[model samples]
Target: MGGSLPRSVDDLPLLPDLVAPQAWSADLVAASDGLFERGVRVLRDGEGGLLVIGDAVMRALAQDPAVGGTPVEFLTGRAGDRVRRATGAAPPSGAAAFDAFLRNQVFTMNAALHVAVRRVVARHLVPRAVLGMAGHAERVLVGVLDEVTRVGGVVDLERDVAGPYVTRFWTDQLGVPAGAALRVQQLVHEMNRMFLFAPTLEDRARVLAATEEYLELVGRTVAMAWERGDNALLGHLARGLDGIDLPGAPPDLGALVAANFFDGFHTVAVAVANAARCLLADAPAAERVRRAPSLVAAAFTEGARLTAPLMLTTRMALGDVEHAGLRIPAGTPITMAWIAANRDPEAYDEPGGYRLDRPPRLGTTFGGGARICPGRGATRMLGEVALRALTATSVQVRLESPQPGWVPGSAIRRHPAIPVVVRRVAAA
Candidate 1:
């Protein structure tokens, strides 16, 4: 849901070449400040095109009379059809078109993974395991806290804690093959590298190769589950890949598995790292969250809002439409800067402040409308469990460095590596 791009906007290049992760952060802050005081500002992109970055513009686009329908349709199937008709090309099947659409844009695996993981998570075996693992993770993290006092130094949260938790959960609880889980971890690391720095052709090749292999691993696992006649697994798989029509109705299991790996492991890893960074930045907040495990959800939501594991969302205008007095012709690309929307002062109080007590509000983190993230519940569950584990453990964390930065891709926002020191607390 968060991944689709409108046909009109597909070819439009909205992001600058020097798109840094911090770039949007700055832009969002400026936009928020300006919007609060002066109303909406329609800035022009580098190519003499208009770009709307204010909350009112986003709200108007989302709710105005001219644009009131489904917010996501402009970037998905409907928009694709419009583009095909305009270009005089054969209309591709929805599933095939969606697949192709994702390949061209950034971090579309989120949508693919939503389909894939939900299949697995909805399975009796997997969901049970996930819930059980959540409990186990809480215990493990709490145990780690108990041992923190012995080390009495900073620890790398990702390597020492987050990575290990994921590795253990996927391998032991989820029943994924041990080797595959390890490879997934490696793939996650590689993705982090490629996303953060400019990689050479060889490096890109290596990452893609590993990605394919990991997908195959997941495919095998899903197949095994299906062989066991897991109804939930089968149903989830069928619905998630509903748009994809295979020969004799056999699912393109490989593609589905690949999508899962891309969406599941990678984004969660980034979210965990960013959450930890946020905790370190505000020690009091960390302590508060640790004491109240239920606040885990709030912390995760806030982290996602601030860091936005996925950054930019794109849509194409279905027809020539005038929005807020701006002429957005048919087949034009529209880049919805979710980062800007989440930080909009009008929607959020103290737009820049990280407050866990904020009301139950939906942010653009999982997106909005029909294309909203289906795996939202599971993602929140994962964050809650992981945070619970860390907080329960008697682990002491100290930020050893300055604010950990993010690597900005056209779609996903990730931190390269956040180095911190964690030590076990000795028994009293």
Candidate 2:
């Protein structure tokens, strides 16, 4: 098993120094593009790990559970312990429970447990179930666009449309009280800060606090659904848990529900904003989508490929694995640069441009294999509804700036607020 392969990922040639963080934010695609342009498929991540590019390598590693296993504290177990071990300080008060809660999350589970939980969750997000919600998504988006029409002028797409639309959709699905949905959304947002690449001590504390509140709300919502005998998402989860006969303690139903809901909600919100920004940046594409609604799905696919909402997903080498002529030592963390893989020149012709003609299943934006995001179908459906609704209107939408103003974070690609001018146009 040990011939000419490099002993460690660090032995691989490293990319030259990266630009400052602010510069990376200015052009989110530049850093990955630069690395890909230099023919650097593997490089040290500087955190004693490796960053991998190229679509084929990423897809292979992602599929092979023997090689790539989730190692992120946010996804796996003992986040609090890791923080304490790293900083030599006691973690937040709820850190232990929070970590335990995370361990039961679908992304963190392994083998049979992961399969069992995913089986329950995937049934709800399948094409049929997601299609059943299409009318709801369209109605919600149309209502938002109607409001945007009423409040003509400059509009923040993230704030005015994506945020509210996604929140409403999830809240309605989860059966949260109308008066409490906004607060639930706020709690989820706060809980999300813990995902930042290097969250501050304060951020960790806030996440723990927010997790408690979020779980409480979710529990109450699910209980209410059960009381009313409604088929809300949480109620379905509750019923689904009863049939699972996994070894060890029963899974934390509330944590599973909260984690899954937050993942779907947060990613979809960012995807909607990012896709909108991508669509608005290209006039001809938007007009094409406007003329042919069927093209909206392709537009969303192209947009997700270009924007890559979830940029980097990490995994630890479960065993010494050789790939692309280099050996990644066991225990070394591998960061799959999804954003870079999505834009790989070898994989796509003109990878940077947003074009709808790209064939289906072309990118790693939604991930691949076992961990391929189960919410992908829902994300595509909702994004298509949003783009279609925006195009169906007789309003002119123009970006306030050529480049999107991003939410300052190293974790995900998201625009905090996509400001645009929306002026009413005469009906044709």
Alpha carbon lDDT at 297, candidate 1: 83
RMSD, each candidate, Å?
8.4, 3.5
Q: Identify the candidate with maximal lDDT.
A: 2
Candidate 2 lDDT, tens digit per residue, 287-397?
Answer: 899988899989998898888777877777778777756777787777787887888887899988889878786588888878888888999999988888777657677
The local distance difference test score of model 1 is 0.53
For candidate 1, the per-residue lDDT at 184 reads 69
Which candidate leads in TM-score? 2
Total backbone collisions, model 1: 25
- Write candidate 1's Cα lDDT for 114-137 as tens digits: 334444434433445456546655
Worst 10 residues of 2 by lDDT: 1-10
RMSD over all Cα atoms, model 2: 3.5
Worst 10 residues of 1 by lDDT: 1-10
lDDT of 1 at 337: 63
